[model samples]
Target: MTVVQITLRKKRLGRSLAGDIVLFGLLALVGCFMALPLVFVISNAFKPINEILKFPPDFFVRNPTFTNFYDLYHLLAGSWVPLTRYIYNTFFIAFVGTAGHVIIASMAAYPLAKRKFPGKTFLFTVVVLSLMFSATVTQITNYMTMSWLGFLDTHWAVIIPAIGSSLGLYLMKQYMEQIPDALLEAAEVDGCSEFRIFWSIVMPVVKPAWLTLIIFSFQGLWGAGGAAGSMYIYSEQLKTIDYAFSQILSGGIIRTGPSMAATLLMLSVPILIFIISQSSVIQTMSTSGMKD
Candidate 1:
């Protein structure tokens, strides 16, 4: 309560406040920088074809119009494959693939995280190493495996491989490790079977991890157009909306307006999903490696 102590405390508080202000100001600047592309996409979608193709393209639209969306709708309506069919295929694959990835990855992760077993370290190590390899590196192997399994030209070719994604398994395992061993032991003592403990206890506790995994899996599947569709899907009706939209975008310079509209439509779903699940993702990341 002395004046010196009070003055010193006031100085410390002032410096801390200044630091926090600077930190938050920098974060805001960086956030806006990162958001520019998304804002540009939205702006371009509403722009007239003339603005889109102007000598020097403007970042924002001068005269926004719905003509682009109308053109896109009419073009899709006149396509050989029904627009609804394409939408259905995209949703089916994204949903099924994301669900499968979350379940299978969580199941695989549980044992690797909590159970002691032979080669457990090696197995987890392999999963970690696999993350270093890009999908393009395994493209040929996946194709051959899918062909051997008679999954070629089928939705299974995409869904099955995604279900076994190493990234999801790795993330789930890391999250599960933060669960206390005593908690699981208590569940076992209370007559909970291994599956029951996993489903009832572990899964609920690690919900944020799997929710984050769902976002990753869904985005990947939703955006997959060329690699899976061109290689594995031969039927137009079975092709995803992304593939259909991609075809529209490739229809030369005349289709610019509609292409921009299609681009916006395609980007909207994954962005919405991320926005909804982002809180869970932040929660998972914050405590990912910490133990109870």
Candidate 2:
């Protein structure tokens, strides 16, 4: 190669390496910042009460112990209800809520993504716009409606609303749009029913999308306000793990160590779920809605 070409190539390579180093450094900083809370949760779970209360509390555990977990067990052992009951209630709600939401959202999304129908544009527009409104902003109105429908203090109040969530619908619709229209059209020509096509064809192809939805739905329902709030669920048996965790936190200064343990326990499941399903989520999210 010419001397000028060799020098220019070396300069470009050096600049590229520098840019990469800077980019990765920034990413590492952000990752550490994001991980701080998780590290704190894990480290503090093993810390003693004194360490937790120590001024300028250290982020890492100095001397770890299982006493906190032992104390947490004994504390919950004294509760009016068994700890298993709270766990059961949380899982029941999470599973049912996630299943119902996935089915309904996928069904609704298929029509919006694949069909030409009356009011389709308007309906989809409304769904998109609804995402702008937060639940806290509409809680009063929602509660009033639920009360009028005699859904107050019922599990239905939580499950029904979540089943129709806009986020799930939006994600499913965007992903469904990526499915080739020609395939669906071919299925129709073979006399395949729309419902059959959706269940047997579309649903199978969009595994990544629904897996993403599953992660979202499960995490949301597991930590839902309805599960913990006294207004919607008054029955002790119906209250979830989140409510039990709140009770632990309210146990005051003496139970602070256990409370940190409880927080980590609560966080672990969702973190695991995301870690397991994150590959699918990233793949689908990156390319969804890009098909013509």
Candidate 3:
């Protein structure tokens, strides 16, 4: 190669490196900006009541204390309903709802994605259209349906509705479309039943998609607190941990520290779940092969 060509190639490489560095720096800045609220929550959880109520709030706690956590424990302990009961209700609903959502979504998505059938286009269109409507828009309809089905004032009211979430179904369908038809065909040629193929082959291959679905579904159900159940569940014993914490938050300004502590405790579960499965979530989002 001539020296001039070599020098030009070197310049291109330099420019590419500079562009990459600039992009990385910008992304880092944006990430930090997004993380500020999370950092502030963590900081406030450790702050003393005096610091929490200071005129100008400090970003970091100067006098860290565990008093908030202690207060939260005592307050909840004094409630008529046991703290363990609230915790049990929350976990039961979140886990059961998330599991049902993942299974139902995946099962529905598989056929819509890989098989040709009558009304497939129309059905998929309905799902896409459903995504445009917020849960609030369908609240009255859902309540009526639950009432008709005799599901009102029960855990099933929350679990059953969450199981049919359109978002999870849509995401699974899109991700499943990326799986090659050849794989399913091969399984069928070997005399594998549709259910067998779905459970064994398709499910294992689409692990990332469902993992992402779990994160989304669980986060929604977890953060929903009593709102999802409030309309259906009137029994105090059936109330979730979030509902209980919300009571603490409503206890005037004096409960600010404990409220912050409760907020952190509530957020910790979802954040931890996301951290554990974040790689799968990223993989599912990044590797889609769907074509318009």
Tens-digit per-residue lDDT, 1-292, candidate 1: 9996899998887787678899999999999999999999999999999999997899989999999999999988999999999998999999999999999999999999999999999999999999999988988999999999999888889999899889999999998998999889999999999999999999988988899898999999998855688988998888998888888668899899999998899899999999999986687666654355
How many clashes show up in model 2? 0
lDDT tens digits, residue span 92-122, model 2: 8788889999999999999999999999999
Worst 10 residues of 2 by lDDT: 283-292
Tell me the lDDT of candidate 2: 0.86
* Structure candidate 3, residue pairs in collision: 153-232
Residue 128 lDDT, candidate 1, scale 0-100: 98
The Cα local distance difference test for each model comes to 0.91, 0.86, 0.90
List runs of model 2 lying over 4 Å from the truth.
1-26, 225-228, 282-292
lDDT of 1 at 75: 88
Indicate the residue-level lDDT of 249 in model 2. 62
- Report residue 29 deviation for candidate 3 (angstroms): 2.1
Find the 10 residues in a row with the least total lDDT in model 3: 283-292
Q: By lDDT, who's the top model here?
A: 1
Instruction: Name model 1 segments beyond 4 Å from true.
Output: 1-15, 283-291
TM-score preference between candidates 1 and 2, better one: 1
TM-score of each: 0.91, 0.86, 0.90
Q: Is candidate 1 or candidate 3 better by TM-score?
A: 1
